[model samples]
Target: MTTVRPLSCPHCGGKEFSFPDKGRCRCLACRSEFLLDETPKPSPARPSGGAGPRRLAALCFLLLLLAGLLYALAPAPAPQPASQPARQRAATPAVTYELQQLALAADPTRDGAPLVLRVRGGLGQKGPAGYVADCYDPRTQAWSEETQRLQDAVGKNAREIRFQAMSDGSLFLVLDKSRLFSFDFAARQWVDARPLLERQPRLAGGVVQIEIGYANEGDALRVMTADGTRRYFYPAVDLAPTYDELRRMVADYRHPQAERRHGFTFARKGAGTSGPQQLIRYAFLDNKTGPRLFGGYLEWDGEGQARHVKRHAHIFRQAHLEATDFFTPDRVYYRASVAWADKEDLIISFRPTPHPDAPSLLQSLDPEDGAIRWTLQCNFDGELVKTADGFYLLQGAKLFRISEGRRPLAEPQRLF
Candidate 1:
């Protein structure tokens, strides 16, 4: 903060002081002035006189004569030896590794062992004790029982149980329409109830399914229902999108006649409810300018609200064709032929397929815009697994890597 201030002269008691660009300031009183510091500058060269020019000409002739005498006395340099041909070495090709369906956990505990995938079968009449915790190990290449039913037998209403590894080396299990349950592997005990799934509204027909969406901020599991409703399940926070907007998306885009189920995406910015949250309907492509809307299909903002903002068209334009079944996270380095798009601003991959009657080939669309990015000859299931180099695509048991820049590798390698 350099500031300018007026200075008063001591002699004449004048208030004026000069601040010059090239020199120091001077006081107007008593005509007192201080000399400014000067920098040293190189002096300009002067023209040479006639005597110097003649001497320089004589030196040049003497130098030429000395060079001729030296050349005449010295033998011509021997011809340089013929250069030998450099040996050509063959290029080593990139080593490709076959991607096996290896089990992966959330945390690193065991050394390259299959993850403990626990699944609850049909509930028996044995009460809570009947619930079984079956462990899937890659060493034995089979499911082993780590612990049997400690409590009463589980009820027969038990369907598929969702299992995910926690950061604390614990397994999270949530039965459909049930509360969240955490199983600690180290302590070998069922701790407090980890609420990861949201409760469903009671209807004439019971809620058929509740699939976990992409992971959002705070590591909350975004839950999707058979209907169009979506709920965010973190530790203690709960957020549901607008009911009317979800219903409209289901009726218009996902499940038109109530026969099919619509998809929903939740992208969170930070942890807990304080963070920015966006709930988007997985349907249509459209842009917005304040109240004015544009593009092919209209969609709600990421927060699942009706805020009229520009739908990201740049990503859409890059996506030539879109697929509903894709991997989470847009950038994948697996040896697979699968890629993801921005599902509600979240990363997910998809592959496009051609129509039965139309001759137009299917192309991968950019998430920024609806424009196509890559053309695919065959249909892809979009099952991508992460590997060391890139993501692994498990298509018909053949593993392939989806290279950088959205290009599919050659043939797939057999994992089995």
Candidate 2:
């Protein structure tokens, strides 16, 4: 590209001019000349001034050649800024469900506030696939049998169940030889959903176990098995079943046949044992690695591919081994010598049997080694209310703060 600028003669006021090579400009008026020597000049003569004309001519020619070469090599006009490539986005944080409230009322056992249990069971009688869920409220405390009937409780067909409640309110329910069904508490209806392992996943040695965890987002669920395979579930969207591949899963909920096993003992004040809201058998892993988890059913069905799911394993990772024999709903005083160890390992002992009975004996693990570091044995009179500090154990018509630990917590004067 070239640019032109007008040249005028100062003396004669002539407007006409012609541009020449090498920075030179000529004006017709007064015959004025400007920058007529942009071209390279010959190097100064040697100090001795003895160089021949032929030698000087050769030097001048080389200088001119070098100047032409330099001009030719000048950079081309700055190129248009190269189109910037699109930036990649960071991944979303994992989903998690945290506690919103533990509503308490005069008769929590009567629905104003109810205890929450995350469980796993079958969808219908002998529904082939077992599933898991937060089995809403108890039928006894429910509004009425008719209303309760409207609710979708885990049917009898479910043969196996496994559950874990994370620090965040996220609840994981795993089942086997069955599938899951989701309930819309507000709608009093069952949401149409599919089973995650509808085809059931099989594992080596023909053993399988299922486990679930909720990430920090609370939007998705992570599923894991004894075999190290993982899957994720997004509750917000519908899942495409055609994209799923049914893998082999644990064939039965029989603990004797399980590749891994965990046990529990649920008992109340004087009661030997009680039935659980839901029941299912499962294998347990002893460590954070190596052992595989296979077999489990979910509470609801949607996105069916387990491979595509993300398993945040650390959420339910416990540090103690729980006594697994007692699986009941009646017993309040329950002791579980679980798989992991530590105070935060979730090693707890419940007391007083189910509802109305209140908790009596309590135990927790040591945060350091998951050892049974604390225990509470109480003889009280009425109902009970619990908090991190202690529990208000009620027996008969009397209410008392039944506490046992390093420093006994002071009993509050009154509780409405």
Summing lDDT over every window of 10 consecutive residues in candidate 1, give the lowest-scoring window: 286-295
RMSD of each: 34.5, 25.8
CA-lDDT, candidates in order: 0.39, 0.35
lDDT of 2 by residue, 1-416 (tens): 55344445554656776677557667776666666443234454455655677798999999999999999999887769766555534554443321111111122223322333333333454432233233323223333223122224443543444333332222333444233334443443334333533433332232233334332222233444455554443332321111022121112112222234443322222223342212112235332211123312211112322112121233223222222221332222333222222223333444434565565544544433334555655433333434343344433323344443233344422322
Per-residue lDDT of 75-152 in model 1, one digit per residue for the tens?
789899776555534554443221112223322344322233344443432232234444543334555546544234
Q: State the TM-score for model 2.
A: 0.24
Give the CA lDDT, 0 to 100, for residue 76 in model 1: 85
For each candidate, give its TM-score against the true structure: 0.32, 0.24
Cα error, residue 13 of model 2, in Å, equals 99
